[model samples]
Target: MVFSSESFLFLFLPVFMAVYYATPQRWRSYPILLGSYVFYAWWRIDFLGLLVLTTLFAYLMGQRVAAHRGSRQGRIYLTIGIGGCLLVLGVFKYLNFFVDSFAALWGTDAAGLGVHWRLILPIGISFYVFQAMSYLIDVHRGDARANARLIDFAAFIALFPQLIAGPILRYKDLEHQFEHRRHSAELFCDGMARFLVGLAKKVILADAIAPLVDLTFGASDPGFVVAWVGALAYMLQLYFDFSGYSDMAIGLGKMMGFRFGENFRFPYVSRSITEFWRRWHISLSSWLRDYLYVSLGGNRKGAARTYVNLLIVMLLGGLWHGANWTFVIWGLWHGGLLALERVTGWHQRAASYWLALPLTLMLVLLGWVMFRAEAVSDSLAIYAGMLGLNGFINDPLLFGAMSRESIALAGLAALVAAAEPKLWLIFSNAENKGPSGAVVSTRFPAASAPRAHASAALAHQNDGWTVTLATLVLGAYAVFRLTEQSFSPFLYFQF
Candidate 1:
């Protein structure tokens, strides 16, 4: 169930938290495992089996890797583990795309070839599978030790907060917390506030603006005016939607005395695509960099090889989002820009903040068009509309139907996005320091993007009551918005 849904908010959360706190400190994972399983099973019982099997397989493989560390056996086990997990992901996520592409080559579809069955991808397969793979990789790399206790390892993988969508928790980052988590009223409250703020962002901003974005993108030819408005509107919608989900997941982890690291870090403010990837989906970017990019020799090779590495990493990263050409192209777009910036030294120029900011934003918005579209043709049409290849108001009904409420909310969402850095600084005067403030250190330097540790920062900034009071006001309003609206699944959940 989605966090914003009434059933989850009113039923699952309240009941789960009570049971969680009632359990003993050392045995808390029992309740966590039970509740998390129930939560995952809420969607489908059959899917729960895959999750369980994946957890068991990863845990066992990790143990084997750990046992054979630094040997040929260790490398084989690691490859087996990674390959097995990717096999599951590929079958469920990309099998259909491959089948269709093959059929097209033969001038026939899957049905024509008598391949009638279609696979249903389990929700969060991409995320949990990656987590499992990362566990084995880390174990083999000696970055993290394999946990002998299956329960804790199970709990780590199936942790419901990030089970469906994630900040992509790493065993290395969160392992110590599992061994000994500090539970207190203050941390829980900070988490709750962060959850509320994310809820507000999703409901009041993202969801509110979604109808207009749909109307625009759904148009036959939205034209210049509608296209730009829709693109900008969608840009904000996606940011709030995905980032809001990350905040909630992180906050929920914090509530449970586990802190998921930052996933987003105010990417819109970035002056270059290099900086943008560093901030946008910080978890995934860092993961690709550490595991795939570095594995492919990173920048250690010559400049030409480095540029090729960038393209290949991003191309795969884009495909990781979906089995769509649009996503592949989106990855290439950013990858190309990153390579260009590296060659020209534009990323480090520091002389063009005024010019860079808008240029970067426009570039990002263009990439996002591809990201949001269903097909390459759809994205190309949208680009044509934005370029006025189709005149303004070609699809009059779509443009005319856009409500003022959505427009206003779109504007408000942009305002909120702009004010994010300031918002974190609002309640306090102190420069924050350390993990107690909720940001964690990672192996990569770029992993240390300035986090939107809003609730954590705010709670620490204030004299207690103010944080509570402010959160209450925001939470109540966000709840009102939630209950009044139809269910809107988080955008990232599809990934």
Candidate 2:
């Protein structure tokens, strides 16, 4: 079930949490694991077999890797085992795409050369595949211990909070938690507030702009102004959709005493493509960095080889995102920029905030044409329209083009979210900083108190009555929006 669905929010979550907390301490894991399977099976009952098989295979492989530590044969066995998991993912996810592409290029139907069975890709196959692969590799590398308990290993892969979509938990990071986790009132409350904020973002801001994006970009005769606005709307929709989902996953993990890492970090604010990558989809970046890049010799190689390695890694990373050529092009676009930055020392070169930020955002926006379009030609058409090739004055009366209220509200929301006024900053920052606050205070004593004090002062800047009234208004707004919209599946789901 989708996290945003009424059935999930009003039914499944309540029942699950109630049983989860009420279960005996010794038996709590079973209830949580069972609840997770129920959630996964909501999408596809057949997929559960893949989940179990992969979990069992990874666990056995981990034991073998740990047992034969320091043996070449053991290392090779681990490689083959990990390769087996990837082969399953490749066959189910990409086999059809490969066949179709080959057939198109050769002017022959490649499907005729293969089995007739069309595999339905199990939801979250990409996520679990990477998670399992990471666990086995870490065991071989001596970074993590083999998980002997099959249930614990299965729970690691099937953990509901991050199961459907993920922040991509590393085995080493969560190994301790599987052995020991304590639920507390503070953590639950913190998690509730975080999940609520993300829910609000997705239901309120992103959902509100989605119709405009659909109307404009989905239009066949769209003009330049309409195209730009549509692109902007989609960019926002994508962020709040994916990042909002990540926030919910992380928040739910906290409530269960499983800490998944942050997956997004205000990537929209980055002034360079390289910086943007660092901030965007952080978990995937780290996963690729640690596993693939490091395995490929990382920066240990000379500059030229390092560039080649980066290219190879990114191309694979891009392919991992989807079975489409557009995603590959999107990955190559960023990879090419990164390579150029390294060679020309442009990474160190800084432009003014005004120039650099907008330019970088434009580059990203143009790239999204490739990402969001149905085909390469569609992407090119959108680019041409966005460049005013179809004329810029098409939408003379903006209010007439879209309803006056919609344009105003979308513009205001964009400004507020993008500028991130003090109140919004304080709310999101303080909410997420619960456990990390002590570390922050200890490391930056001089800045910590003032920051909190400034936030408090801003809270009181408006009269208490006015502030309370605004909160009520926004809360009402969120509730109204939630009631009107259905769940918007995160864009990352296609991966």
Candidate 3:
């Protein structure tokens, strides 16, 4: 169930929290594991077995790899573990894509080739499989120790907060937390406040503009204005939607005393494609950098090999998202841009911030067309309209489809997305000011007291009662919206 759903917010979360806190410290992992499995099974019971078996396989292989460290056998075990995880992901996620492509090329039906049977992709298979592989690899590389405790390992893999959509926690980062965690009222309150902010982002912002996106994208021949409007809407929708999920996931982890790393920064404000990748989906980008790019020799291999490595990493990274040609093209598009930037030194060159910001955003917006489209052809069609190759006339139906609320909310979403960091700084600075226009100080010496005090006060205000009250109000509004609106699945869940 989604975090913004009524059942999740009102029923599952309360009950889960109650049971979780009631369980003793020694056996706390049991409830988390059980609750996680229940959460996954809520989507599809049959796939729950797949998740368990995969977890067991990874856990067992991790032990074997750890036992054989520094020998040929260790490398062999590592290869096998990695292969097994990829095989599972391949069969479930990419099998159909490969089969369909082969059939089309051969001018024959997939059934005739005995590959017509479709597999149901388990939700979060991409995320979990990657996690499992990283765990096995880290163990083999002697970067982390394999957990002998099956329950704790399983709990780490199936942690419901991040199981479905993730900030993609590394095993080393969370291994200790799984074994030992502390809980307190302050921590729990902070998590609740963060969760509420995420809920509002989804229910109030993303969902509000979704109908306009659906209407425009679903149109058979939306013209220039309609296509561009829809593209921008989808762009905003995606950020709030996926980032909202990440926020909820991180917030939930915090409540349970696990600190998942940040997944997003202000990516929209990036001045270059290089900077954008650094800010966006930070976990996945770092994963590709370390596991894929570094493994292929990284930038150590001179400029030519480095560009090829970047291309390969991004191509495979895109494929990891889904088994679609559109995703492949999307990856290639970014890879090409990144390569060009590296070769031309555009990334390092000084440019006007105003010029760079819009240029980067336009490029990103164009790329999103590929990411969001159902097929490569549809994406091209959208691009054509965006470039005004199609008529510039506005579609009346598309114009009428967007309600005033949708338009206002879309504008607000854009503003928030663009200025959120600055706004937060402003609020933080305001909150840090003391009575009588003086700055409060506790830790700093008299000379540097004001600056240090501002920093300390910002942190204090973040966790204070003001945040709690704001969370309550936003959470109540989200709940009301959940009851009134139709079910809106998270965009990243399909991946």
Candidate 4:
């Protein structure tokens, strides 16, 4: 079930929270594990078994790897663990693509070979499998200890909040939290506030802009202006949609006394693709850097290998999203840009954002078209249209499909995305003094102790109330809008 859906928001969450909080501290993982299973099963009961088997297999292999650390056995177990997870991922996620591509090259298709069966990819398989593999690798590397408790480990893998589309969690980061956690009214309240804001982001912003995007991308021949508009709207739609999920997941984790890291950090404001990776889908980037790139020799072997490593990491990273050739090109686009930046020293160079921002955003936007496209030809069409090859702006079908509310909301989405960092900073740190979050900035001059302190305290109080009231209103509106709107699945779910 989607976190924003009525059943999830009004039914599952309330009941889950009630049961979870009622459970004792010592056996908290039981409820979390059970609740998580129920959540996954809600999608498909059969797939739930796949999740369970993967979790248990990883747990068992992790123990062996940990036990044999620094030995050939440890390395073998690690390889086995990773290989097993990848085998599942490959078969489920990419086997179709590979089969079709090979068949086409061989002047035939799967049907000709009597291979009519197509593997069904379990939802969130990529995320959980990656989580499981990371756990085994960490155990072997001594970065984290393998949890002896099967329930705790299982819960970590199946944690509902991020189980689907994730700010992918690592055992090393959450191992201690699984064992020991603090629960309080304050933390829970903060979680609710955070969750509400994320709900607004997804329901109000992303969903609002989706129609325009659908029109543009789905059109037979959306012209230059329409294509740009669609591209820009989609850029906003994807960020709010995926990042909204991350925010809600993290907030849900907070409610359960788990701390999930922030995934997006104003990636649009990034000066380079290098900086963009550092900010966007940060968890995955770090995972690729540490596990894949480093494992592939990183920058250690030589300059050429370093570039190759970057390209390979991004190539696989792209494939991790989907089995589409568009994704392959999307990955190569970023990977090639990364390699180029490294060679040109552009990533390391200091430049004004005015100079850097547009260049980075244009490249990112173009790559995003590839990421969003159904096929290479579709992407080329969008690119051609973007260049005015389809004639600038005049697309009657696109115009007819647009709505006023959606247009207004798209504008608002742009504004919010642009100001996202500041908005997060303000509410998230409301109690802090001044707009800049300083105790003695322009609003509170260093002066007589009592007067200054009292004024600052009053200001902080106002900010706190404002944040609460604003979030409540936004949350309520988002909820209302959600009830009125049709089912809109998150874009990242396909991954």
Candidate 5:
């Protein structure tokens, strides 16, 4: 179940949290593992076994790697562990794509080739497999110790908050928290506030604007205006939708006394594509950087090799998203741009925001066209319309499909997406100010005070009656929409 669903929000979460906190500290992992399994099984019971098997395989392999550290056996174990994870991912996620592509290349029908089996990809397979691989690699590399307890390791692997769609936590990042974490009224309140904000972003904003995007992209021959409008709508929809889920995941992590790293950071404001990757999907980008790019020798190689490495990493990174040619092309498109930036020094030009922002956004918007399209040809058609190769006319069908509410919400979403950084800064400054125009300090032990004060500051920022009223209104509206509208699955869930 997604976080935005009524059953999940109203039923599963409350019950899970109640059971979780009520369990004793020593046996808490039992409830967490069980709850996490139940959450995964809610999607498909059969895949639950696959998840367990993968987790156990990684755990065992990690132990072997740790036991044989600094030896050939350790490297062997590490290779086996990573290979096993990738094999599972490839079979489930990419098998069909590979088969079809091969058949097409060979001028033969895939069905006649006797490959009749069709794999149903488990939800979140990509995310959890990456985490499992990272865990094994970290253990082998001596960055983290292999967990002795199966339950703790399993809990870490299957943490429900991030199991489905993730900020992609590494084992090292969460190892200590799995063993010891504190839950309190302050953290819970802060988490609730964050969750509510994300809920509004998804339900009130993203879902509202999704229809216009659907109408335009689904058109037989959308005009230039329709195509651009749809593309822009989708740009806003994707940000709010995926980032909203990330926010919910993070907020849930906080409530459970675990800290997930930031995922998105006002990527729309990026002045360069390089800067955009740094801000967007921070976890995945860092993962590719460390595991893929670094493994390919990174920039330590010459400029020419660095460009090649960049291309290979991005191409594979795109393939990791899905078994689709559009994703591959999307990856290649970004890789080419990144390489051009490096070779031409456009990235270092220090262009002003007025010049840089639009250019960067336009590039990003064009990329999203490929990402959202069902096929490469559809993406090309959208691109053609975007470039005015189709027609400059505003399609009446497209204009008629958008409601006034959607248009207004789209405008609001764009404004919020652009202004969110400044809005947060203003709120932060206001939160730090005291009634007497001075900073308030709490007296506590040095180590404890900072954590306490930070939590307090978050609570303070969200504590105002105005914030409360706004949250309630937005939440109520979102709930109303949820009850009335059809299910709107998260976009990233397909990956």
Candidate 6:
């Protein structure tokens, strides 16, 4: 079930938390594991078995690999384990794509080939498969020890928060947390704030912009301005939708006493493709770097090898995001840009931030069109429209149909969201200085002893007034949106 759903947020989470906290420390893992299975089972009961079976198989193979480490047999087992994971991924996710391609090339109906198997991809199959493969490979590489306990290993793979659309948690990162963890009131409160903010971003901002995107994409011969509007709205929608989900996942992890890493680092503000990768979907980038790039010789090799490694890593990275060819091209697109930077030593020569930043953002924006498109031709068509090749915006009907408030809000949200880091920094610095930093405050500087003065003034703002007001506003908006049946599934769930 989606974390944003009413049942999940109000019912499932509260019940899970209650049981989780009530369980004995030693047996805590049991309830969490069972709860996770129930969550997955809500999607498809049959798929839950696949998750359990895959976890068992991978965990067993991981132990075998760890035992045989540094030997030919160990490598063989590792390869076999990885291959098995990929084989399952391919069969469930890529079978249709492959069948269609084969049929087209051979002029034979793929359905008549007798090899066609209609498979319903288990929810989170792609994510957990990658996570599972990473575990086996890390064990083979000696980066992490294989867990002897089957339950512990299974929990690591099936952890519900990151199971569906993940920051793609690494085995090594979470290995210790599986058995040992620290919980605190402060972390729990902070997680609530983060989760609320993420919920607002998705339900409020992303949902607000989605219809514009849907309309633009759904049109026949979309006008140039309409296409640009659609593409821009889509870009905003994607960031809020995916990043919002990531935020919720991270917050849930924190509340559960698991410290998952932040996934999005304000990637919209990145100044280069390389910088963008470092900021966006950071965990996945690091995963491919450590597991794939390093295994493929990494930067320890010369420039030639590094370039080849980057391309291969990116190509697979794109495929990992989805089974579609567009994703493959999206990966190659970034790979090519990275290669260009390497060859020309452009990354070494820092251009003016003014020039470099927008250039990077534009490149990224264009790339998103490709990533969002259903097919390569649609991407090209949309891109052409974006460049004003299609006379979309001149149509008065589109403009007149859109609410001025929505248009204004869309523009404002994009600008404010892009400036998120600066905004957070501003509030943070102000916060450290005490009540003096707050405008229209009741207390003046040095009205009393420093700590006491700060405490009294801080009490005014922190008395749940601001939080209650914010919550009420957001809750109202969420209810209105929910009533309208305007919920949009998170973009990254497919990954």
Number of the top candidate by TM-score? 4
Q: Which has the greatest lDDT?
A: 4
**Residue ranges of candidate 5 with Cα displaced over 4 Å:** 351-353, 426-463
Per TM-score, what order, best first?
A: 4, 1, 3, 5, 6, 2
Model 4, 367-486: lDDT tens digits are 999999898888888888899889986677677678988889999988987888788778767634332224533355567598778987787788889998999999999999999999
TM values, all candidates: 0.93, 0.88, 0.93, 0.96, 0.92, 0.90
Cα lDDT, model 4, residue 377 = 86
User: Any runs in candidate 1 off by more than 4 Å, and if so which?
Assistant: 427-467
Worst 10 residues of 6 by lDDT: 428-437
lDDT of 6: 0.79
Question: Candidate 1's residue-wise lDDT over 62-113, tens digit each?
Answer: 9999999999998999888898899999999999999999998999999988
Q: Tens digits of per-residue lDDT for model 3 on 217-320?
A: 77666788878888999999999999889889977986887777878877898999999998899989999998889999999999999899989999998998
Q: In angstroms, how far off is 453's CA in candidate 4?
A: 1.2
lDDT per model vs. reference: 0.86, 0.77, 0.85, 0.88, 0.86, 0.79
Candidate 4: give the clashing pairs. none
Instruction: Kindly report which residue pairs in candidate 6 clash with one another.
Output: 223-392, 224-390, 224-391, 224-392, 225-393
TM-score of 5: 0.92
Task: Give per-residue lDDT, candidate 2, residue 268.
Answer: 77
lDDT preference between candidates 2 and 5, better one: 5
List model 6 lDDT by residue over 275-315, tens digit each. Answer: 88988888889989988898899988899999998999999
Using TM-score as the measure, name the better of candidate 2 and candidate 3: 3
lDDT of 1 at 473: 89
TM-score of 6: 0.90
Which candidate do you rate higher for lDDT, 4 or 5? Answer: 4
Error of 4 at 82 (Å): 1.0
